[model samples]
Target: MRVVIAKCSVDYAGRLNAHLPLATRLLMLKGDGSVLIHSDGGSYKPLNWMSPPCSVSDVEVEQDQADAGITEIWKVVHHKTADMLVINIHEIFSDASHELGVDPGLIKDGVEAHLQKLLAEHIETLGEGYQLVRREYFTAIGPVDILARDENGGHVAVELKRRGDIDGVEQLTRYLELMNRDPLLAPVQGVFAAQEIKPQARTLAEDRGIRCVVLDYDALRGMADHNALF
Candidate 1:
C-alpha cells in the first residue's frame, strides 16, 4: 500500500510516516497541500491540508477527499487493478497528540495486551498440549503473526488476518522452510489458519504435506470441541 502525503510540511512528514504500517510504501509531495493514498483496488484523492489547531474531523475530511478522488481516478487509470483506501483519522490525531507531548505508549500497550489476551485464550483452547509461542517474527520470507506448538512436541505456525487476498500456501511454505531449519522444530508440522482458505492455497498445502485450517469467529467458538492432538 502507498501512503501519499501531499503538501505536507517537512516537519510533519516524518511524524506521519512513523504512524504508517512498516510495510506501507510512502510518497511525499511537499508544498502541494494535498494528500492521496492508493492501495489494493482503491485510491484516495487529494484532500484539504492544514496545519495544527485544526479539528480532528477537519483533518479527516481532507483525508477522505484525497481517498475519494484518488480512488476514482485510479479506477479509471487502471481498470484491471484493485485500488482501495482506508483512512484512519485517529492516526493523524495520534500524531498531533505525540507532538503535544502526550504519551501514546500506554494506549498502544493496552491495545496490545487486549489482543494478546484474545490470542492466548483461543490458542490455549486449541488442544491440551498447545502453547502460544513467538509472534510477529520473521521467518524465511517475512514476519509471521504467530508460531505455536502442539503438546506432542510439534511446531505450528499461524497467520492471522482481518481481511485480504493473501497467498497462504506460499506463506506456509516459507514458514515450513524456516521451521525445518531449526533442528528442534524440524519434527513439527505447519498449518495455515485463516477466516477462509483459498482453493489454490489448500491444494498447495496438501501437495506439500502441510495442513490448512479455516477458523472464523463462529468456528473459533467450537474449535475446542475437536481433538486437535489426534
Candidate 2:
C-alpha cells in the first residue's frame, strides 16, 4: 500500500464524470490497486476513489511540470469498465508505503444492522419459501448480512443497505464471489436488498445475474409483528 499527501486535482470519467480542483489531499493506493483521494474530513470515506480491478500507470514528470511543482501524474483504468481516474500531483507533503495483510472487512452498524435483523426474521420478505439460515454469516473476508435457502434449496446471500447504490452492489458481488467458492455454497445466489436501490445499481446487479430487492422497513416490521400475533 502507498500513501502520498500532495496538492493535487482529480478527474474521473466512466459511468459518471467528476472533477476535484487542486487541493492538498491524501492519495491512497491500496494493495488491491484501488486509488482513493481523501480530504481531512468526510470520516472514513474518500473524497474520490476508483474501485479495484484497475491498473495504475505513472507519467514521467517533465521539466516544465517540475518547475510548477507538478511532480506526478497517475492514470488509473478499470479492467472491465474501462473507466478512468486521473490524479495530478502538484506538491508532495508526505509519501510512504506499508505492508498490510488481509482485511476482515466492515461490521454493519446503525440502520444497516437493524435492517439486517429485520430481514432475517422476515426472510419470507425475500420470497415465499426463503428460510433464514443465519444473520451475520461470518467468512474470511466479512460477514454476509443474511444467508438463506430459497424454495429450490439454493443458497441466497443478501446484502442490506439503507440506500443501495453501485457500491452496495459491488459489495454484495464481493461476498458472493467469496462465498460461492466453497463447494457447500457453490450455487449461492446474490440479492442486493435495500430500502431504496438506485437505477444504476439495479442495472449492474441484473447484468451480473443478481437479484435486486427493494426493502420496506415499516411494512416488513409490521408484518413480522402481525405474524407474531397469529
Which is the leading candidate under lDDT?
2
What tens-digit string does per-residue lDDT give for candidate 1 at 1-230? 12342222211221122223322222322222222332333222112122211121123245564564422111111112211223332122111111224323322244334443456567864567788887664542345667788987677776553321236566656556545545555665776665566777677777888766665554544453453645
Best by TM-score: 2
TM-score of 2: 0.55
> Each model's RMSD to truth, in Å?
15.6, 8.6
TM-score of each: 0.41, 0.55
Question: lDDT per residue, candidate 2, 21-86, as tens digits?
Answer: 999999989887778888998654567776666899998988997897787989999786687998
Clashing pairs in 2: none
